[model samples]
Target: MMRMRRKVLCLDWDKRTVRLLVARVGSGRMTLEDAHAHRIPAEVNTDDPAALGGVIAAAMAAHRIRRRDVIVDVPRDKSVIARLPLPPTPIAELPDVVRFQAVKELPFPVEDAALDFVTLTADAERKTATEVLLAAVRKDVLGRIRETCAAAGLRPARIGLRPYANLVSVMHLPGMAERRVLFVDVGPALTEINVVHGGRLAFTRAANVSVPVLGDDDRWQSSRLVVVGGGGEQDAISGAIHDLVVEVVRSLQAYRATESNVVIDNVIVAGHTGVETELAQALEKRLALVTDLFDPTLPLGITGDRGAELRGFSAVLGLAWGLSTRGLLELDFLNPKRVVRRSETIIRRARLLGMAATAAAVGAAALTWSAYRAKAAELADVRKGMEDLRRVVRDARDLTNRSAEWDEWQYDAVWLDHLMILSRALPGPGREVIIRSLVCDSSSSSIRVDLIATNRERVKQFVDVLADLRAGGLPDEPQDSSRPKLYRVEQGSWVEGNTAEPGFSGSTQVMLRVVDVEEFHSPAAVNARKAERERFAREF
Candidate 1:
C-alpha cells in the first residue's frame, strides 16, 4: 500500500476537477505550477455522496493514492456567510454564542449545517470590543462535498465556506486592494458580494445574481472587473458585469463626500482573463485602474503551468494552502482530530455531570437521615424558644422575615471583581448568558466560576476569548490599575484526546483586576464605560 498523503480535491458544481497543491507537512501551498486537471465522466452523479467513491477507489488502484482526510469547498450560491461580533476574551467562553446568534443572523436556518469560522482580523484584541468573522456553509451543500469524499473512500474533514477561502487567496496574492475593495464572485447559481479590509473578509451578502443576470449588486465590485463563469451567457453576463462597476464608482463618490481622505485606486477582477479585460476597461474609464482576477505569484512561486492551475480552483487551493501550516489545520476549526477530541470531551463532561448528580442524591439522602435524628433532640428546645418568640414577635412584627431576606441577598452577592470585569464584557440584552455559580474567596479574593453551557466546547471557547482580552491589553478596569495588570483564564479541567487511550488534557479559567481608565475613555465618548459595564453584568 502506498503511504497516505494528505490531499485537497476540489470539484465545483460545473464538474471542473482540480487537485489543489496541498501537503500534510512542510511548505504546503497553492501552486498552479504542477497544475493537474481532469474532466469527470458523466457516468457518475457528482452530487451523489457515494458516486465519488468509485473514482477514489479507482484512483487508489491506478495511482496508489490512499489518503482519507479531505476538505471540501461548497458552492458559493448555496452557502451563506455573515460577520458577527465576538465577546471579549474572558466572555468568549461561549464561542457557540455566535452559532446560536446565527439563526436570527442568517436568512436561512443554520441548525442543520456544518459550520467553520475564520478570524479575519489578526488583532483579536480589536474583536474583543465588537464582532469576529463568522462564515457558515449549509449542511446540505456540505453533504455533497462529504458524499464525494466518502464515495472515494475518504473522510471529509471540513466543508469550508467559499467567500472566506477566496478572500484569503486574494489578499495574500501580489499587489494591494483598497481598504474596502468590493469582491464579486460570479458563480453559476449565485453571485457573491463581500467587502475586505485589512486583509480580512468583513461584510458578506449574496443574491440570485445568476439566473438571466437579475439580482442585487449594491455591494458588487466594479462590473468592469468581472469574473465570468463557464456558463457565460454573453448579454446577461455583460450587463451584470457593467452594473458592478457603476455601483463601485457611486459608492466611492458617496464615501468621498463624507471622508475625503479615503482613496480607492482601481478595479481588480479574477476569472477568465479574456472576459475580465473588457470589464476591467469599463471600470478603468470611471475609476483609477482596473486589474485582472488574482496573481498567485505572491505566496506560491508560480512560473507558467503552476499559475494556470490556480485560475479555476483558487478558493479551494487557498483553503488547503492555509491548512498546510503548523503541520495541521489552522484555526483548528472543525478538524477531525480536534472534532473527535471535542466530542469525547462533551461525552466525558456528560458522564461527569451524571456522576455528580448521582453523588449529590446519595449525599442528600444521608443528610436527610442526619437531620431527622437532630430534629428529635432539638424539638423540646425549639418548642420552648417558640413560646418565647411569640412575645418578641408581638413587640416587633414588622421585623419578621426581614432577616431571612437579608440572608438571601448575602447569598446572591456576586464577587466584586467578577462583577466589574463581567459588567464591562456583557454582550447586551439580545446577547446574554446566565451564570450558574460564581465563587470568590471573601478573604483571599480568589475567583472560580462554574457555568453550565449548551455544550462544553462553547464554554471552552468563551474562556479562550477571555484570555485574549488581557493579552490584547484591554481594560482590567474597576480593579487595581497601579502598575498595569491583565486578567487571564487559568487552565480549567480538560479531557483527553484519545478514545480507548488517553492523550493530552486541558481546561480554562479566568482572572480579573482593577485598572485606571485614562486612554480608554474620551471626552466625547461614543461608548460609555457604565453602559458597557451593564451589558457585561447582565449576563452574570
Candidate 2:
C-alpha cells in the first residue's frame, strides 16, 4: 500500500492585498510549506479582470509556484450567503431544490448567478426540516474571476467565501466546539461576524468598518489618554473599532433573542488588521464576554514565525485544512462543465493509450508470424540452391543487397533522437507546459505534437526554443544541412470561457520534420541514446 500525498494552494485576496499559501496535506494532517503576500496597486481596479490577472501572475511567479490545485477566497462583499430551512428532501433532488431556492433568495436573476449549497444539519428520521447554507455569486463576477485566473495560468479548484473559511479556522479552538462563540474577523475594509454553535456556523454577516492601517513592524500602541478616552485621529480609529464591537454585540443579542436556548459565551477576534490586545480588551470590557485573540494554528502543533503569521492567514489556512480533512463545508463555484470536460479528457486519454497498446501487441504478433513464414520459405529455397553451387552464390549476393537496403530504411534510433530533440527544445522546470499528445510518421519522418501551457508567455517561449532547436543553436545539437525543420505552428485556446482545465488553458500545435537519420546511426549517438533511455526507464 502507498500513502497518497496531496498538495493544495490556497489564495485569499481583498482590496489591498492577495495572499498565497501552499500546503502539503496527508494522513489527516496539513503542513504549511510556503506563504506569500502581494499588495495591490492603489490605482489598479480590483474589479478589472486584466488588472487582477497581472497581479496574480506576478505573485505566482514571485512565489515560484507551478502547482494548479488552488482554492481562492472571494471577497465577502461580492457574495450572498444565507441559511435556509427546508422540508426534508432526498439527497438526489437537493441540487434542483437549491437552485430553485437561490432564484428566490438572490438579488439577481437565477441565470446570471452561480449557486451552491451545503446541508448544515438534518434530521435522521426525515421528519423535520433541514438547515442548509446557500451561497450565490453573480455569473459575471465569477466569470471575470475565472478569466483572470486563467490568464494568470491558474484555475482554482474551489472559490470559497471568506466568512465560511474563517469559521473553519476557529471552530476547533479549545472550548469553542463545546460552547457557542462569536468569531469576529476584522479586515481592512470589512468586518466578518460568524456565530458558531455546537461546532457549526449558525449565523454570518459582513459589515463595512475601518481600522488603523498598521505596518508589519508597527505594534499597536496608543497614548494612555487616547487609550482611555481622547479626541484625535487615533481616537477616531479606536471609536471605529468600538463601533464594530458594538455591531458584533448586537448580532450576538439578536441571535440569542431568536434562539433563546443559545448564548454566545466567548468572542474571538482574528484578522490581519485588528488582531491586537487593545481591541480584544475593548471587546471584552464592552460586551462582558470572554474575548481572546484567535490563533488556530496553535492546535495544529505549528510554532515559530510562520505560526505567528497565522493571524493574517486564518481563512486560507482554513481552506487548506478543510480540504485535507474533508470538512462539512464543500462549496465551489468553478464551472461544472469545465470539471466534466477535464474528466472526460482524462478518460479519453486512458482509453486511447490502452487501445494503442493492444493494437501494438497484436501487430507485433502478426509481424512475427509473417517473418517466420518468409524465413522458412527462404531456407527451403537456399537448401534447393545448395544442390547447385552457382545458384547458391547468386542467391547469396541477392540476399546481401536486400538486407543492406532494409538496414538503410529501418533506422532504429530515429524516433528516439527526435524525442531527445523535443525534450531539449521545450521549457523544463518552473514552466507550466504540458505535451498532451504526440504522433510520428515513419515514412515522412515528421512529428506532430499538441501542447498546453499556463500562459501565453510560456507558449511563446516554447516556440522560440523550437526555432532554436531547428537551427541547431543548442550545444548538444550540431548545425547541419539535414537538421530538423519546423514545418507548421498553430496556437489556439486550450479551454474556452470557463470550461478550461487549470494550468493547461493555452494550446499550441507543432510539426517538425526529421530530415536526416545518418547522424543518429553513428556509434556514439546510438550509445548516448541508449544511456538516456536507460536512465529514463529507471526513473519511471
Candidate 3:
C-alpha cells in the first residue's frame, strides 16, 4: 500500500464549526500537518440564497485550500431523505436497479431526488448490502449551496448524510478494538444512532433530542462514542445530554441479547461544544457500562508532529480512507465517462500496432531467407562453370605440347600444302587461274578455297579431281548437286570486269567438312589427288 495524504474539509451544522484536516496515513501513523477550525457567524442566515455552507467555505479559504473532499452534517429540521435495499445482486449493477426502485419508492419521483448509494458490504454468497442515501432537499437550497461552493472555489466531490458519515468515521478510529461497536452522533435537533457489528453497519436510527446534556468528559472513548450535537441555553443543553445517555444504555442492553456473540465494554462521547470529563461522569452514574470521552487518536500507536491534531477530524479522514478501497461504495463522485473512453482508445491502438509489427517481422524474415538461397544457387552455378573451363584449358595445353614435340619443321612445310596439291590435281590445269585465299575451319573441319578463274571449263577439271580423290578413299560426296551438300562445291558469278573470255571472269569456291577419309597409298585408284598434285607441280 502506498502512502495516502489528503486534505479534508468538514462542517457540522449542529456545532457550527468548519474544520480542515490534512491527514496522511502512513507507516502505521496518521499525521495531521495542518488543522484549522472556525466558528460560524451567529446571524449569517445559512438558509439565505448565499448563506448555506458559507462558514465551512471560509475556513477552506483561510487555509488556502482549493480542492478537498467535504463532509457536511445536515441540520436537524431537514426531513428529506432516501434509503435503498441492496442484496441478491452484484454491486456494479446497483445504479440501474436503484433508478428503477427509486421511481416507485421515492414519493417525489426519482428524477427530483438526488440519489447516492454507499455499499456497506457483500457477503460471499453474492448478496450485497448497500445504503442508498437520497436527499430530497429544496431545489433552492441546492442552487444556493452550489453557487456558494462554486464561488468559494470549492468542488464538493461527495455530498453525504451527516449521520452516516459520523457513524462511518467513528468506526475507523486508531484502535477501538471491538468486533461490535456502537456509533452515536447527536445533532442540534436530531441524534443519529448506528450499531456496527461484524465490521458492517447493522442499524441506523434518528431520534429527536428533547433534553440536551453538555459535558467535558474523557470516559466515552471505547467501542461506544456519544456525539452530543451542539446548541441551546444551559438548561436546554443539560436536558439534551440526559435524554441521549438514557437511550444509549437501553440500546446496548438490547444489542447484547439479540447478538449474543458481541460484548459492550465501553462508551465514548464525541462532543460538539461540550467537555469530555463531565459527560463521562454523568454516563457512569446512570449506566453500568464505563464511559469516556472520544479521542480518535487513541491506543497511542501513531507518532508524528501532528498526530494529536488529526484525531478530531476523523470524518474528513474517513472520506480519504473510503477512497483507498477498490469497488467499495458506488458513488458518482468520480466522473468515469472520460476515463472509460480514453482506456478503450489506448487499448485499440496498441492492438493494431502489435498485429502490424508481427506481420512485418514475418515478411522480412521470409525475404531475407529467399535472398540467401538465391545467392547460394548462383555461387554453385559459377563454381561448376569454372571447373569445366579449367578442364578445357588443360586439354588445349596438352594438345599444343604434343604437336610441338613431333615433327615441327615437317608439319610447317606441309601445314596447308594439301590445298595447293588439290588445286593442281585438277584435270586440264590452267582453267581456273589461281587460288586467292584458303581458309581452314578447324571447328567444322572444313576447307574452303577462293578461285579466280579464266573459263567455266576449268571448274569441271577441278570437279573431276575431287571425284577421283573420293574414289581413292578420301571422304567425298558428288561434286555437283542442287543443295550445298557436304564436300560439294558451288561456283560464284563471273567477276564483274572486262569479259576476257565468255563466262571466264568469276571465281569458284569449294567448301567441305570431312570426318572420314582414305589413304592414297592403298592403290585403290592411281593418280590420286595427292599424287596428281605433285605431278602437276613438278611440271609447273
Ranking by lDDT: 2, 3, 1
Which pairs of residues collide in model 2?
Answer: none
Off by over 4 Å in 1: 1-33, 39-66, 86-92, 108-110, 119-129, 177-180, 207-240, 243-266, 272-274, 304-309, 326-540
Local accuracy of candidate 1 as per-residue lDDT tens digits, 1-540: 011224454323333232333334223434332323233454666566576556545544444444566665655556655666654532333356656766777776777755555543334554343455555656666566666666777776665666666666666665654355655554433545555666666555554433232222212221122323344467876776566565555545654564467545434554422334465677677665544555565566545443433455556656666555543233223441112224344445555555654555555555777765554445544444454554444433334345445533443343443455554553331132234456665333345664333334555555554544532132332332343333435645543322221221222234432111212323433155446445544532
Residue-level lDDT of model 2, residues 1-540, one tens digit each, is 012447888888777667788888754567778776666776778778788878878878866888765788666678888877777866555667777777778888988888877777676676334667888888888887787788778887888777777777776566676777788877777888888776566788787877664542212221111112223367757877778878887877777776787766888887665335677888898888889887765666666344435666778877877777764446677642112223334445555555654555555555677765665565555444333444444455566557655655555434654576677767762357778788987655567877777766776776666655543234245555454543334444444323155755556677665544434455686587668555644543
lDDT of 2: 0.67
Worst 10 residues of 3 by lDDT: 332-341
Q: Pick the candidate with the highest lDDT.
A: 2
Give the alpha carbon lDDT tens digit for every residue of 488-514 in model 3.
444455554454445457666766443
TM, every model = 0.49, 0.57, 0.48
Best by TM-score: 2
lDDT (C-alpha) at residue 341 in model 1: 27
lDDT of 3 at 456: 60
CA lDDT of 293 in candidate 1?
59
Model 2, runs deviating above 4 Å: 125-129, 216-233, 304-307, 335-540
